[model samples]
Target: MNKEILRLPLYTLIAGFILGIINLITIRILIRGTNEWTLEMGKTVFYIELILSIIAFVFIGILLRQKYNRTDFFKSATLLVIYSAVVFILEQIMQYWGFYSMINSYLYLPVSIFTVITSLVARISNLEHIKWLHVIPSIFAPYLFLLFSKNPSENTAK
Candidate 1:
């Protein structure tokens, strides 16, 4: 049995969980106030942090591909799902602890999706003949851009 199969996905899962932890901690500190002024600031900080995370995923995913020679698309997607699930579970647990609210928590789902898609694309790009397949991931880049472009409502930004 090839070790790369287990290694890549496991590493991705761990990295995803770590990043999610960082995200929660950063947001907690940045969003200190409950009023409108602080709310707006939180929204900006959230988007900025999300973008930075996405960028980090892109680079890390690409590096993983180079190191492990990952080519299976399903494996890549599954790895991302693992990461997303870990973050979601952590967020839910935190909410239950009264550290964060449940309102608009689903918004974090996109971060996981976009990060995986971006990383998958980066990996697929390395293939020799499937030149067009590499472009599919770029489509999701607009979604990432749109995330930053929209004005998050106070109610949904939580």
Candidate 2:
């Protein structure tokens, strides 16, 4: 059996864990001015998922570049999109498993958007050609982040 398949999840999990810590620090910074830490804490799971997807996009790009020894923007972008979807689905499964607070229903779109931005950055920094269509996903990322940071489900009945 090829042992390489076993390393994939390990890579994904390490990527996820690092991004989770970054997400926690981000949450801390965002909530520093507010009085409701407990409320905000419940949203950490969503942020962790979002941040993990973003980082995973870049990580995947790096891996592809190293493997091919060239920048293939379209290929990397497509893979990033697919990978983001998989991660989002897995997060939903974990939430259903009661591993974290319920994922905010509105979470998926924003994370997908941010994943595009991060992937683009990774490509551009490595001198990949700019594809205008690829820019679409990042256009609303800032606003989406603001929306996502608010914990939309916190006050509602699921």
Q: Which candidate achieves the best lDDT against the true structure?
A: 1
TM-score of 1: 0.41
Model 2 spans > 4 angstroms off:
37-52, 64-158
After superposition, the stretches of candidate 1 with alpha carbons farther than 4 Å from their true spots are 33-39, 78-158
Q: For candidate 1, lDDT tens digit of each residue in 80-134?
A: 4555556556756876888976533453443442444544554446653434344
lDDT tens readout by residue for model 2, 1-158: 43333233344445545565666687777678887667456456455655567657556545533333212333333444555566556755876898854353234332343544645564556656645455445543323222222133433323
User: What TM-score fits each model?
Assistant: 0.41, 0.35
